[model samples]
Target: MPPPSAPDCYRVPTTPSSGEFRDRGSKFVAVLRPVRSEAEALAVVEEQRLAHPKCNHHCYAYRIGPGTDRWRANDDGEPSGTAGKPILGQIDKEGLSDLIIVVSRYFGGTKLGTSGLITAYREAARLSLLETVLAERVLTSPILLEFGYALMTPVMGALSQLGLEMADQEFTERARIKLEVRQSEREATVKELKAAIAGVYLAEVHDTFVVEGLTVSLPG
Candidate 1:
């Protein structure tokens, strides 16, 4: 049998999601938010801390970038490996990146043991992720084309035929257009466009990233 195909896309939360868990009168509130960078993740954690100043503990876990190399888990004041590890484990189990989860605990005049704390944190994180709407995003690279006005017809036609969308454009003595093509289609798109329009200048790729093309339809 042929080898299994590698994944070309990834799932990400469309918006912030929240969940709550209660045990032995203690309240655990989980907030899951999609973030692109470490700075953004830290900012969200700070925001949560400020919002719940009375909370006894504010523990968090975050994963950023395309792989697991960039990630962190903070136990805060909780016992070692009780809070943050469980929260991070949940994120890894869900196969999610570019996300941060904060679990704030308010002591309810009761002390839950280590096992209880772990279960509560993990379940809270799982519930928050379950409540999120996830989108499948594909990676893309941008190409900027600058050509003479004489090539307008062919240039526009080539873009339309390739089903590529122009991200930006400028009309001047020379027409300038920016296009984003899927990384896998980059070479083909450039070859087709160059063949259609002579003297089409291809600029360096300005940016490369992933984006959701359409909303996923969930089953009832």
Candidate 2:
């Protein structure tokens, strides 16, 4: 098989989602939320813990950033791989990042085997994700361009023609415009802008972000 395409876009929940799964009398409630960082993800988990203080366990999994390298799965008090691993598996299966899923379990006077616990947590997470409204987020990099006031007209015209938005602008001795360009289009945009106006200073990209766009559906 050919190599997979680089991930320029990803799916993320538009709002919080909740679902429940009961097996062998044990109840598992899964809550899914969009998060941009590990700190945010942990805060969500803490909120759930406070809301369900009597629960027996609070297992969770989170994935951050564009690459799959930044991720974590916590079993909490459940068996080694039964809770967190299954929950994370569902998230990965849906090809989503920048999100977290937490499964809270309430003991139902019965103990579910390792396999049963895995299935229950996985099902709960899947159900929660299914109820969520997702959006396709495109990654963008910030570009700062500075030029003399004499070149303002041509620079603005070039930016408008290229369909780029100005995030910020300043008027001093020179004109400085901040633009958010899609990562894939950064190179071409810079080249075109330079060719359109002389003495255009294209600064190095220091930050990137993902912005939500149209709604998207995940494969079942």
Q: Point to the candidate with the largest lDDT.
A: 2
What is each predicted model's overall lDDT from 0 to 1? 0.78, 0.80
- Estimate, for each residue in 1-220, the C-alpha lDDT of model 1 and write its tens digit: 1232225555667789999999989999999999999999999889999989999788999988665599999989999999999999998887777899999998898789999999999998989988988775666677777776666777787777667788888888767787776666766676656654543344432223111121111111
lDDT of 2: 0.80
Q: Quote each prediction's TM-score.
A: 0.78, 0.84
Model 2 spans with C-alpha error above 4 angstroms: 1-6, 198-220
Best candidate (score: TM-score) = 2
Q: List ranges where model 1 is wrong by over 4 Å.
A: 1-8, 170-173, 198-220
Error of 1 at 21 (Å): 1.3
lDDT of 2 by residue, 18-97 (tens): 99999877889999999999999999999999989989699999999778799999999888999899999998888888
Error of 2 at 59 (Å): 0.5
What's the CA error at residue 121 for candidate 1, in Å? 0.8
